[model samples]
Target chain A: MERTGAAAIIIGNEVLTAKVKDENGPHLIQRLRELGIPLRSVETILDDVDAIVDAVARARRRARYVFTSGGIGPTHDDVTVRAVALALGRSVVRLPEMVSALHARAGDTPVTAEGLRLADAPEGAVLLAQPGMWFPVLTVDDIYLLPGVPQLFRLQLETVLARLSGTPVHLVSLFFTLGESALAAVLDRVALDMPHVAIGSYPVFDASLDYRVKVTVEAQERSQVDEAVGRLLGALPTDSLVRRE
Target chain B: MERTGAAAIIIGNEVLTAKVKDENGPHLIQRLRELGIPLRSVETILDDVDAIVDAVARARRRARYVFTSGGIGPTHDDVTVRAVALALGRSVVRLPEMVSALHARAGDTPVTAEGLRLADAPEGAVLLAQPGMWFPVLTVDDIYLLPGVPQLFRLQLETVLARLSGTPVHLVSLFFTLGESALAAVLDRVALDMPHVAIGSYPVFDASLDYRVKVTVEAQERSQVDEAVGRLLGALPTDSLVRRE
Candidate 1:
């Protein structure tokens, strides 16, 4: 119930319209899991300002950290910065550091007024310099503004995750030969009894699969997970369980 | 500005926890696009009751049709019916048709009390008999509660989409050698002038790609899209133009 995990908001119209597939959401899910951080949610919405604001505000209320992908570029659809600022009730201010960086990068060519829009960010924003890249990860009040591009998103995500810590959850999986209908009662009992341990029941419809239902019991403490798995094993039909890991 | 698009709520802890990759969201997006229906958003949230309620409420306010995936089963985690009911300000009730179908399918073996939970639905629910399947598609209002299983989700989606109508959007993709920052001014001008047409600019970071940015111009009318594309081509530098489709 405590808001400890991270939440993601992927801002892209191309993905919703089927012009492009979203690779950032899945990648973020995998990375967050690998880092032992539990993810609260992933919302893929259009590149609209109000939608981004709503998503970011909701995500902030339910999570300690919020990460938004895309809509940070210097174009018409790039409204993430403005939206995130609105959500945080902050003014969009041009970062002098970013302006200097852009000027330095441009060198001989003058940075256009539109191109200088990249220097803008929510007030009190912090920039985490990314190695081997010019654009730093723009962040404010635990909300990370990540690029929509897959490669950049992955890189910026690593930069953000390095600063956070989480407890790794210990899990035990039990696969059964019987279906969910036969296993629901027992699972309900264990799940209800062990509030600390998270129990998940998934049924496989494919006949080719060896197991019919996959039950997962997980907890921050290994002992709790093991105890719940033991109780499940004891209550379930011995012959019905195909394997446990 | 009107609520005309479809929105999706993917209720699954497995997806958020990285236990399983979500295939249903992408499949739904692709199918909705093929059906010429605009997708408002796709939110992947936990199986928590309050989470489902909040997402459903927000989705209903934004889109005409809402599709929810997962959490429809005979287990404790299967709380979609209860959550959706609360969202719609309705009560959960047992569907007599579902009860009869369960009885016919079970035959000689009696169904468990927990198994009978599958017969429960939100008030004023309708069951669309799925072709070649024993179970039917559970729907209420414009919300379709689909199974989590990939195959079942795909099949049920087709059945739901068949009943809906949409106008196919006319799209024109233009690839350019110039980056977003270089083309932002022209794009902003055309995008502001042609409010009916939607224009998107995306930058490519990879050097392997031939183009620096891919610009998308789309509208329900082909003439609007073509006019926007022509305006963009005319405004942009002739040498910087790559190709258009």
Candidate 2:
């Protein structure tokens, strides 16, 4: 089975400057994993138009779905929409519906020229609308434009995920007190035996925690993952295995 | 003055799967900022050789320096060295000095075949040796290969930073109770007036916190940043300004 490929572009200078830690990349990673789309790559780039355009174009070529977070706000730094449009050779135009929505939402407050920029997107882009959402999500070609705010990004992602479907991967994880080196040989053997399964070994070195390595087995077939996990468990020393509920 | 550009490649499947939250990207970002190099891009790619090569080559073209974290370990997944070599059109070769170091460090512990893989690097790569460090940091061309462990990556980065230099950027930030929309016009005006300084406005929506917006000003000179900050402070509504030490 061919796995669907996905890539994410996290656009913000705050994230790159380390002033604001990114909550979007990790959130999107988990969501893509749960959706069974193999997130091939994630680029956290500065709020530069050239960089944004290059990242989006590269991601578009590499993956079936591309998600971008940040730079959609009404500010000097917000340029993702225009960048995406330029990258895809499309022109950015203001949507009348979004302008009217902003007008309706702004009642007592006056909408500035910058505020109206939020209504603009790549030509032919689709706006995703849902009840109670203050703003609609924008989709241009295969790229999904999402807000930088963690709360809004998560909410919009859920709505986006509902419209997309993918094959779910079966995964099994086993924790071991033994170091990664101790399990390397057995993992290599198991991996060679099961070419279809993807095996990963992650070491967690915490003085407070007893677990040293977390070995994960993933495959399209549940039986393949289970078989690899069973073999891995049998190969490891019983004393090193960490049993958890 | 032109700013020196830097980019990072975070190589691992664990990170892409969300099984591991990346500590490397944030750590590197902070370090690069302190070192005064303008980090342009950060790519978190899987442990695939092609992906690693593509990311490294792209970063190398865009930035003066490229730092890659992870995939240098002694395992099936550790392919950073080879991938980087391929990307740079070089061949991977085992370094006798590294092998000797590994042997010396192993003492009573037997060095497995996988463990010996740590001795390999790109043909033209230079290993950075320092006092008190168990293993030397690898540098092929401009790409610095760092370990995934936060502690190790930080240590290696400090050593790496000592050899490099960049013009420092001065920054000043102010918090305000006023929302982003309320301050947008003033910020636009300030940005227009101070072309050399970069102004950014970030909104924080927390019911518990009084501060709604955090405006940051950055420039090559401290005076320029301070000038922009002064103008911004004077332009905002006095009642909405949040005083901070």
Candidate 3:
């Protein structure tokens, strides 16, 4: 299948172990949505080479773009670069540009051997100049290896997203007084008939809310979304629909 | 490999589309940590059957318990039950217990066919009686099928968690004034020496914080954690060490 959307892999042991609540995954999801780039999945895994390799390879197979958060530091746990290289069947190589950049940043101070780990990347890697940051974005093919630091992740993400293009989906939501069980058939029929249109049914449990369920119809074109919504509204009882947006 | 921990699959189109920030994944991670169960991974995928099946099968292979959130309702989008059944190579069957419970809940009113869809589950599924709720926790093998609604998910999760057991990890944190580049070598040595202990190095960019990096040492035994911490503290520069916790 042709890859279209983006996929994210959050290599965060701190997040999986609950030491830190993951800000990157949610932030990436929100930013990707705002950019109108459809996201296929967001996987949170440990900072292990095998797991990272598997996740990266799987993401590449399904998504046009793969964004990885965390595991991009000098520490031993920072194995995303190596794992990603293995996933792409490439050897890890020290990028001369990154080495030069590190030396420039260090100035007169001698860069430690461990510090030079920051310069290592997949054999064929490109660096995108980042504004206001010493380290540039590390990218190979369509995969972007981002630092786990929330601040750094945000800044680098902005730089990467600026270069990509997306088509924003047209969406309409219908609020219903009836529950999913009451509205399932009509939704099933409309969703089945308009396979291109993406339909979502979300049940709301809050008694304070006026609606019981919220049905969303979305597609690349406004006409498809509108047509699907119209079909759903027509098939369902008029009294059931509280409002449509 | 012996499956000892838990893995989660958050089947959420709304989450992937950024219509809703996923509360369930974070909540599950926190709860699992509190319960002393190590979490292997948490994958958030769109509410699609192929995606759900792939994720479920993968989780089962790596974890003793697999928890899936969302796509458990009556609508066309609610395909978790069918998908999970396919993942396990089982046929979907309506549970008599759930059907009876639904009938009892409906009382004088006739239950819709869509409403009875809630009774469907993978063959040989068991329902754990959920206290203070009409629905019980649905389980086939070690997979727990949970609702996407935050409130319902929380309540059901508690019921399921209470039935399982876990061993809390022994953990210690060390604060350093030095960055990861300065600490990588020492950490690498300690981590390589003791494979049992999980060592994590997190760099704090906030200048307001007293420490530049926070290192976590953890294992099943307190002595192991303490030993790892001691090795780390001994190897790093005395002036770089800020504190320990």
| CAPRI-style docking class of model 1 based on DockQ | high
| Tens-digit per-residue lDDT, A1-245, candidate 3 | 57999999999999999999999999999988888899999999999999999999999999999999999999999999999999999999999988999899899988899999999999999999999898999999999999999999999999999999888888898999998898998888988888999999999998999999999999999999888988888888899888888
- Can you write out model 3's per-residue Cα lDDT over B1-245, one digit (the tens) per residue? 57989999999999999899999999999999998999999999998899999999989988999999999999999999999999999999999889999999989988889999999999989999888789999999999999999999999999999989999998899999998898999999999999999999999899899999999999999999988988888887898988888
Give TM-scores for every candidate, taking all chains together and pairing residue i with residue i: 0.99, 0.90, 0.99
After TM-score superposition, the amount by which residue A43's alpha carbon in candidate 2 deviates from its true location, in angstroms, is: 1.1
lDDT of 1 by residue, A44-85 (tens): 999999999999999999999999999999999999999999
Off by over 4 Å in 1: none
lDDT of 2 by residue, B159-220 (tens): 89999988888878888897776788888899988899988888875769879878888999
Global fold similarity of model 3 (TM-score): 0.99
lDDT of 2: 0.86
Q: Total clashing residue pairs per candidate?
A: 0, 0, 0
Q: What is the clash tally of candidate 2? A: 0
Clashing pairs in 2: none
In model 2, state the lDDT of residue B139. Answer: 95
Q: Rate the local accuracy (lDDT) of all candidates.
A: 0.93, 0.86, 0.94
lDDT of 1 by residue, B179-231 (tens): 88889999999999999899999899989888999999999999999899989
